[model samples]
Target: MEYGCYVCNKIIKTGEKFTFTKEGPVHMDCFVAAERKKVPEGKAEYLRNLSMILDYELTMLVSLLSLKSEDKETSELIRRRINAIEKQAGETTGLIYNL
Candidate 1:
């Protein structure tokens, strides 16, 4: 059976190194490149932006885990921000595929 890559939205043939996530199967290299592209232009800017984003995600995850049951609104807001950041990261990393 043919499987589709989550990042490139293309068919993944046999003998490809891939991992399965909740979303779907994704090629290993595609996933790594996508993660690397989640930053600004220039090496320095990219590193800085990536570090900040990772830190923010970590902090939000911690806060989300510690939130009280009644604070549904606050939890939802944080979740939305996290989702936005993830989407931006994915978009920034221009998708590349191997033939």
Candidate 2:
């Protein structure tokens, strides 16, 4: 069975070093990156802060899509970028729901 990295949402290849959280297995680098991130003052604060970031990312993605790039590779890359951002936004929403 293939496991996914929590941060990148990419497959964690066999034999890779990872750490387990209450959520699931995450690559060591991903875990460290999360650890180094600044903690919010409170749940409401965290949600508000993340919401702003998510909003900006979504706005950027929408703007890019409006340009209607003809390059297949560029379009595919944008789709992947949007997917990754949406996934992270969902995870953040889940955290708020849990609290």
Candidate 3:
């Protein structure tokens, strides 16, 4: 199935990069940037929390793009940013590992 970005109205194919949002489908870059804009300056904790939310959202994205796995790459960029946020806040990934 071909998904069209609600913002750009561009035809987006599975794994071609799209973000699932309450507002509907949007480009991945658009989604990430919008998410980043929501974070306030000097708020590492907020950033960390945002990262967690993004990570969970990305996990859902992965599932949605399951059929496009052959041409898809995991949202590693978001993961890296999340890791950095965790590191900056002196938090560890294992914090939630036990849950």
TM-score of each: 0.37, 0.45, 0.39
Clashes of 3: 0
lDDT of 3 by residue, 9-64 (tens): 88876555444555676665555455556545665465566556646555554554
User: Where in model 2 is the C-alpha error above 4 Å?
Assistant: 1-42
Once model 3 is optimally superposed onto the true structure by TM-score, how far is the C-alpha of residue 45 displaced, in angstroms? 7.3
Clashing pairs in 3: none
lDDT of 3: 0.51
Clashes per prediction?
0, 0, 0
> Higher-lDDT candidate among 2 and 3?
2
Candidate with the larger lDDT of 1 and 3 = 1
lDDT of 1 by residue, 6-89 (tens): 899988865554545456777655665665575335464555454455445445544554555458887787677657755543
Best lDDT among the predictions, by candidate number: 2
The order by descending TM-score is 2, 3, 1
